[model samples]
Target: MHATQTPRQDDPLDVETFARPEQQRRFVAAMHRIAAERAPGSSVRIYVSIAPGDANCERWLECITDDLPDGVELLHYRTAFEGAAYDWDALASRLDGLVVIGRPKRLGSRVHVLGPVARLELRSLVATKPVLLFTHNHGLVPVVDCLSQVMPPEEAPRLKLIAPKRWNRESITIRAALDALRPTGVSNAGLESFRAVQAHLLTPFSAASR
Candidate 1:
């Protein structure tokens, strides 16, 4: 797939504006709100990634920028891969929270898959802070099934699934189910998580601590 926008400095997180004027306005407002609530200065930055076939990607982002509180430094990225194997950590390093909006597909009673990349990305992020995964599809439950096998209960709990529709069916392809499983030591925390986890890196948590 072609890279819609190459990584650049000073590029608006919205990148290209929405077709609808109201949509664009709403999105910008939300982002500003989030910025203000989350961070008052340039310390916190927001990064968004758009997956292939992700229909609501733009819409959700618009809402975030337009409706959410202000002072949020939101950045947007169009991903080239299906899983979090690419730039997941890079996007997570600068922000405090991540929002993955999608429809979940179920394989079993509680096993679901939202965005494969997002799940893996979140699983990777949990090594540091909490990641909230939101989806409206019933199939999203199984995405957490393998979590029990990877990390301890507490860590797994940090990777949450926000699914409004719960699935009761178990129709998982063996091959597909195996792909959803996460392996050990495969963390995507990036620099930020590491710093947060250690708490005393090259410098202190904040300049004041020094």
Candidate 2:
């Protein structure tokens, strides 16, 4: 959770050296917008779906928590059906966003196709909630890029996807996902002030913090 370099005041969104400055800036702006628009004292619940017993998936889940906004809460929902809730709609109703973790790298060039786990994840995304796809391996997340790779002319809602090479990048990517999910209301001057709040919340803290 410790960020080696503090963000420069001139560029508050520069939280990580690896992430593009523009992308980070946009991500920060979006996050602040959501916080400002969220109903008072009401949190946005993000459901994190993971395959049970996957060690790597478990680790990334723990690591990503370091950079989450205060109003965001992550709920762990395992995919395996043994004694777990299989009701996607009911779960969807309670969730504002979803993160699908621990996926296999696509073995071939089948973007529109899916496997067992990916299918389950896709079905859950039917509600059109903003989603982010992350795999334990630092490679392309085919699920997010699937539609794009298959048909260049077709358009789908922006789906955030990240496969971080390191823990720091992983946490920052999680922040991007949260920023994409958090809802924002239109405001004239809110952008300027919300930017400051995003900067403060994004400051690195102990993993135990926030």
Candidate 3:
């Protein structure tokens, strides 16, 4: 299935909750503008790739501030609704780093299984870029193990994991999620605390250009 370019009806971006209407409008506009200017192999673009789900998925993309690496642009990537036909190749090749969010079910975790091709394509894309994965701790370890089967061994370290042990996933807001992900400086509590997660998550992104 092809991913739609617009927000899916089930979960629209709630960026307005965090910014003034004008500010939010401009921010959304700027994201699209940056995405529009992109052409294959043109400049570095950091795409927040996702599998569809709850508010945290939306929050993951919303929380990233405009302040980014020099000449780096940000955009969103999501697959089209199940069984909807569309293209994936062009965008897949352009991704520099993918910030994946959500607790994706593993192969044997559920009664039904998934197709191999889409999963393979996604793994291939991940193998080629820096991937910062945010997920429920239990679900992800298995998911990574499964990916290891398909992903190139040499590129494995480039895929980092971030699973907050003390976070309240049920109650956290977009601002809180972003705050929790932000990078904090060196110190005993500072760097290791939830506040520094965002900063640490971004540390390897610059390497994606290589």
Candidate 4:
């Protein structure tokens, strides 16, 4: 099914819920402006790529499909391995943004994930597209280390890796971030956290850009 460009009727709290009406108006305007600048005259076809076992993927997709703007569409790709179904050329053509979502391993646990991807493709992907990743790991150093290798000093300005704004509320920080990356293009919706803080983070950007 196609994604809606406006907020859903069922959501109790959403982008429309600013601290005030002015904030909401500005935020919505900013969103439109940003969209106009990034993908003028072009329709975006987004493809979501995520690990097979991720429980949050469904929730993330629901959030995205419910509120994507006009001209933006979302697809899904679930797998056990990285780029398992990746069609490099097709993906390149389809996507303007990507979100890689994974959990942090407990210190004493044997399950290893997230770190390697950060070690390996973080930079390459960022260089190629706007990438936003969220994880529970406290090791920011490793993320920085990997980014330093793959990202150019100049382009580094475009990369961001941080905690979810408020954990879980009504903000679509992930959505906003994806919008920032591809403007008029495709985006990944595998790791969205729409908490209060995230909503705050997105407000100014959305308002100003629209």
Highest lDDT, which number?
2
lDDT accuracy of residue 133 in candidate 4: 42
Query: What tens-digit string does per-residue lDDT give for candidate 2 at 114-166?
Result: 33554455557633444555443332121222222121223432222323223
What are the per-residue Cα lDDT tens digits for candidate 3 across 20-120? 33533443344444444445335454555554434455444435433233333455534322345435566666655444543345522211122343344
Stretches off by above 4 angstroms in model 3 are: 1-42, 65-71, 78-85, 104-121, 135-210
Q: What TM-score would every model get versus the actual structure?
A: 0.37, 0.45, 0.33, 0.39
For model 2 the TM-score comes to 0.45
Greater TM-score among 2 and 3 belongs to 2
The TM-score measured for candidate 4 stands at: 0.39
Worst 10 residues of 4 by lDDT: 138-147
Find the 10 residues in a row with the least total lDDT in model 1.
173-182
| lDDT, candidates in the order shown | 0.36, 0.46, 0.37, 0.39
Residues 32-84, model 1: lDDT tens digits: 44434432222334344346445565555555444222333344443322344
User: What RMSD does each model have against the real structure?
Assistant: 20.0, 13.3, 19.7, 16.3
Candidate achieving higher TM-score, 2 or 4: 2
lDDT of 1 at 204: 22
Misplaced by over 4 Å in model 4 are 1-39, 64-71, 78-85, 105-122, 134-210
Give the per-residue lDDT digits (tens) of candidate 4, residues 4-115: 1333467422222212434334444454455557744464554444454456666655455444443344545532224576555555455655545434345422122443
